[model samples]
Target chain A: MRERFITLTSPVVPLERDNVDTDQIIPARFLKATSREGFGDKLFHDWRYDSAGCPRPDFVLNDPTHRGTILAAGKNFGCGSSREHAAWAIRGAGFRAVLSPRFADIFRENALNNGLLPVQLPAPFLERVFTVTRERPEAAVTVDLERQEVRFEGETAPFDIPPYRKRCLLQGFDDIDYLLSIRDKIILFEKQHAL
Target chain B: MNTLFDKIWDAHVVEALPGDTHVLYIDRQYIHEVTSPQAFEGLRRRGVPLFRPGQVTAIPDHNIPTLCQHLPVADPLSRAQLDTLERNCVAHDISLFRIGTPHHGIVHVAGPESGLTLPGMTIVCGDSHTSTHGALGCVAFGIGTSEVEMALATQCILQPKPRPARVRVEGRLPAGTCAKDLILHVISRIGTAGGTGYFVEFAGTAIRALSLEARMTVCNMSIEMGARGGMIAPDDATFDYLRDRPFAPRGAAWERAIERWRALPSDDDARFDAEFTFDAGEIAPMITYGTNPATGIPVTATIPPAADPQALAYMGLHAGEPLVGKRVDHVFVGSCTNGRLEDLRAFASLVKGKRRAPGVTAWIVPGSQEVERRAIAEGVRDTLEAAGFVLRQPGCSACLAMNEDKVPPGKYCVATSNRNFEGRQGPGARTFLAGPLVAAAAAVTGEIRDPRELM
Candidate 1:
């Protein structure tokens, strides 16, 4: 997996819902897979499909007008059940980042670990994003991790990204990778503490 | 800086190598059948034997059918997973609690009842609800599948220290309220992501009034708030709960254990990274509206307007809708959250001589064989049967959709399970979370009604 803190390019599909839980994001039936592959198609499977396996035209993502590589959701996105598959599906579906007003704690961590950037913006900022995305269908939003800013078409706003997570994303480091980097220090400390 | 999480992490951190991470030694490891099979396979492939067999305990729960102890597991994959767990445990000489074994139950429930979980120890499990053990004043959290393998092979994991957030519950709980209600209120108020990146410590007067089982209910939902885990200072309640448990100390040993536990409370002036306080009396019987547990309101309250477009669009709920009379097609009372003996007793008392709604299907399941046996002995099973409710055996029966007890797509269920996340009961199944009493009332009314009406 590419670890660099690269810029996201997906069009922003805004979902203004609180408590967007993991099961809704990716259903349990999809969890049976042993490998993490092919989850992209199953992301939001129920919402995207109807009883006959036909695409639901009424769904937001299915709307041809709102096509983007990024998903800008509402407050408390990715709430409920600590399923990492939700993040995996979002990432596999070719989306690199998710911008939201608020993110569920476990879901945020899962997204970050799987290299999916979860951007938390204020409610007002989120509203502004939805307005802009709605008004200008072709609007492109750029999320710069290095600068900690979200720049829309001709407008820019600064957002908060925790310093630790920022460092990890910028360095393309996961929990294990970050820990392994300090292996020598840990070994030394263990040696010194040996009694 | 001196939070329980920091204390535990610092004590266990043997080294900090080149990267911003620490190599930590694990004190205890708990595993269940659902997540351990793949981890064991990984270990086998790597030729890694368990480092400390005694520190690990294995149990089968998630896939075990509730109603039939002898019914061959209908799902081939679930049966294979259980068989794999038993085979692995036997081959590795690890303690395995198979079906019908006295020790077989949800791993979280089994751990505390067995006295294997004690104060001041760090515990790790493969399930997110492992936070349930934090009620014993230990730092416990869930690990991923790969991490489970690492723990089995080396009994250690690399982890970053987490910050602490203290949640204090003061005032006396009103009649009809419980720890389940308190947690639901707290999560709803904070939203689901409120506890992210923090170890929560629950305190104050109202919390003290809760039984250890109730306290476990509160701590079990810590992960729902995005918290790493939750802890409550050990006290008389804690000691009392542990005293008569199967694995607890006896005679002089019991007194010594209590003495040690007494010192496990936090210092009076101890500082926390963050603090939040809520009044217990202000809480009411809470129920979820949208898929997530945090989108909850008092049983009598109307569903809040989906002010946020995303929330409204996703939940498919209109503004100003009275949640009270929302139609429910099913009622589920089971899971580690509310599948205990007390939970069944509460449901049974409410359902006795009361016929369930003709259109509603209610499945009441016990968390373990012990809980089932105790409930049967107390006549709760008979009461449920007479009331037209189906009492299933011990397993995580509809709290999740893993077993055959799933709600049909597009149906609404009032559940006693911890999470009401979208599709938790089944694909496209709408779940409204409530306490057992409230769930019983819903079963009888065929709608989201308050338990107080039944009383």
Candidate 2:
């Protein structure tokens, strides 16, 4: 079973660009592997590496000073393509939560299923977080799923997460477990609504 | 008052849990190579058998080589993935459509042409283009591997109900434009995040006038604008497209199916969470200049001055410059979005007598074996070959560059496929997403030109 995600307080890696798509998270070329693990090295493959396979220093992940467990990105994070590898890569790279003003629907679902916390804060709070993190790389932000709030530098903002998702994250529950428990209902429904 | 989305979604609800989540039963689940291996592995690890194996269909498309289907795949990794899919299907007793079979193609294309996608059914696949199936008026959307495993184990998924939105495009499309242009124009108006939490429905006179295949082209790219999925109410056009296909109902059953389908449209007083209306006459031949599909403008317009500079640098284009006269290095006209037979005909009609440009390399691929067969039988293939375009075998070629159709680094391609994401075609490749006519125009002129001028 994956680790339970309850609350996290850690420094963040800020990606200020909006519409950071899945292709930029994990390119199409790295998707040939059957296993979901071992993708941490390939996360953001194109943006992190040059043609020679050398790390590009200008990229955020390449910088040692900006290490963290949370990825604070601009709006529309995880747009384009429904590849869960993007979520897998982010988790494999050791991040626990993503703080964005918005997230694409499929990606949000994938992130939740795979144990990545997607925190949807307001745009103004995100702007403050970006500004504060830029000035102090080691500054930490706290995400409390139970309280449904994000706290940073004496400022706290309420975020919205469905109660079902919150319970699953708090207890390390899997959707498959819930789905498998209700097999009889599924069969009954299928028999009644035979297409 | 019920919307079409509500009619389909409510019927498929097996149970409703708290927090607005539902255990939605999926009628059809299509599996492909790239995303299904892990899902099958999930089943094996849990030691559970598939609940309804017959409801699932496996077809490998993403990583398969578009050329030489009979030959063994050269890439060891790609070959292993394909082999894994075949083995998994065999083990689970699920139906498989391997390469070289008459039924093989991209799942989105193969599903509709085989009549497996019908009105009011809930469909799903691991790939995002599963939204393409919603063109038949189904509540179809994409899922990840874990959800794929959930569907396999129980044929049901726990989903939070998405709100409904309506985009009504009225009036007739201008002569030079088609469904692709209309969708691109809509995406341009509504930025990538505009439809984030809603399932959008296409309505009004203009959408009703499009053919079934053309409607698929519109719904296929709904994800590009962040919608959960897109659909059009199943009409006579949709029924006619499915009437005689192999998997469709026949005789008395066909009549019954039509009777049910006729009730699938929204009622006159149905209300939506959001509504947007556009005049089809305002849309022109469209093209995307940036990395995302939403960064689109008319073919005759200059790049917006507010365009992202980093995106422009990566595309080797600059703001305040006319996109019309830019040189193009490659032209690709195939994908689940616009790779149907109708798309091929639109391409062939424009490039009929024109010679290929001196420096442009063009690849014309069919979406499915059925499309390929009809393209040849109807002389579209002959016309294309005469215009210096080679018709490649059917697959998702050049759309995501999973196979041998990668555009070289730093080269520009005018393509009719969806998603112009950076490195989507290949490493360092720049793509301009457009309809088939725009791609054909670039193929003949060796540059970006408004397809309207050519017509």
Candidate 3:
């Protein structure tokens, strides 16, 4: 049921904060579900809503002018717990990609597994994007996974992802399918190497 | 030429693909209710039985109420999750450490204590603190739900080899400081993103001198620094800790296992992609002043002027202000990070005859039922109770506040659990991460007094 990632061009939703941990993306209290859907409503739950359940105007997500499929964030994005729900919440919120100067290791993997591109751009380029998005909320950014580049404001920058992961994302291939196909090799490896 | 990480990693390779990706075999997988339900559902969707059920162990830690072992869970959703896990394990033939059982606890804590986690193995759990097993010298890290399902389907996951980094802490730790202080200091020096994209190996004399439990505390928070995982080379101390654990090898098998583990350390000439060295003697009892663990300082020091203003605003702290006398409303002394029997003993020693400060609530939770039982047998519970600190049953209590042990909004808590991120404990709770001694000092003093002063 996952979408095959190829390319996305959309206005950027700017969250100018560093170390946006998974706990903030989706708080621990919301992790009670057995399924992967519907986390979008609770995405950034504490920050999106006040205790009275009203949308906080100061939060970027509440800004009606800035709406996009690509989430642009500051350095060290998704830097805490390895909850895949963070990716689920992002995808559930309709974000197809997250662009940052850097990303936490586990979150990067989780994002990729969920077909949400984690675009790691140069620090200066990311800063330029943030500035552009801040000045013009409707500015669109283009991300091309096939080309491994992000383009915005007359500037284009290349990003890097492991080639294997890129293949998985492009084909919508799940690791579980590949792993299931190679059960014999795994059993052979286990038998040959006894712990 | 092989580092310890390379040795453990290379040994687990089922197949090496292009771009340094390996189909790495997982020797053990720890499961909990919070993260495993979806993974189990994934298996059901695919119509696959667990590939190696014996290698997986399921436990319910997160969302389980620490109080009332005999009672049904009050939260219907939480209870359903727990029931689903039991049903999945029963259907799949995976082992379940049921609640109220002696072995039931946090996966990271119970995994090592039961000897299911061994050196030179590749381990994982759905939880981030799976890195805690790396204290026993494994290539353990947290995985997402998809990866969890992949591991369950074949006991193998495709991963790119992480570049290795070494953090060497030399000299001796100062008195009153523990492994928590050393790690907090490391994070402060390196910043939260310092370890991103690397597997960090904690080395040098200070790390070596730590007891195994203390080493677990250090490795438990590797994820906080954005590292894939943190590991310490298994030494005699590690061997000693695992020797007689319930599931560890016996007699000749134990001897053989130790021999293999002894050879698991990095060669003298092995090279790491990044290296850092710090003096352990200079580290004081450390505490976080901001929402991130990296925003830490020695208890007696003033907050840095360069501290993130937004984080400062969230924490209700000002730059250049000393944290030594800040009032704390609660003290939580438990988590996979510092919730072992050793941690409780350290806490009990600090407040043996003293009383908890009035209006300051303290929850002293152990990491596991076994830890709780040992604390009681060792009289650590009595000391904690005598100090007016209630000894709570083991779960991830108040660490994530999933079980109603939340600190009220805007309350300041000095916590031994890892993470000071906003709303980690509750929606508006402010957490100051610290060691057990520091938590004890805060519990008794009702403020952020240095543990050294109390000592």
The model with the greatest lDDT is: 2
State, as a TM-score between 0 and 1, how close model 3 is to the true structure.
0.99
Span of 10 residues, lowest total lDDT, candidate 2 chain B: B60-69
By lDDT, is 1 or 3 better?
A: 3
Candidate 1 chain B: 10-residue stretch with minimal lDDT: B306-315
Q: Model 2: residues >4 Å from true position, as ranges?
A: none
True contacts kept of each: 0.28, 0.81, 0.86
lDDT of each: 0.77, 0.93, 0.92
How does model 1 fare in lDDT? 0.77
Candidate 1 ranges beyond 4 A from true positions: A1-16, A63-69, A119-195, B1-6, B15-24, B33-53, B83-94, B149-154, B158-160, B244-259, B304-327
Tens-place lDDT per residue, model 3, B1-455, is 88999999998999988888889999999999988889999988988988889999998998888788679999999999999999999999999999899899988898899999999999989988899999999999999999999988899998888999999999999899999999999999998999998999999999999999999998998888888999999999999999899989999999999999999999999999999999999999999999999988999999999999989998999999999999999999999999999999999999988999999999888899999999999899889888888888889988998888998899999999998899999999999999999999999999999888877
**In angstroms, how far off is A164's CA in candidate 3?**
1.5
* Position B237, candidate 2: lDDT: 90
By lDDT, the candidates rank as 2, 3, 1
lDDT tens digits, residue span A1-195, model 3: 457999899999999888899999999999999999999999999999999999999999999999999999989999888899999999999999999999998898899889999999998998888898888988999999999999998999999988888898899897887888889888888889998
| Top-down DockQ ranking | 3, 2, 1
What TM-score would each prediction reach against the true structure? 0.86, 0.99, 0.99
Better of 2 and 3 by lDDT: 2
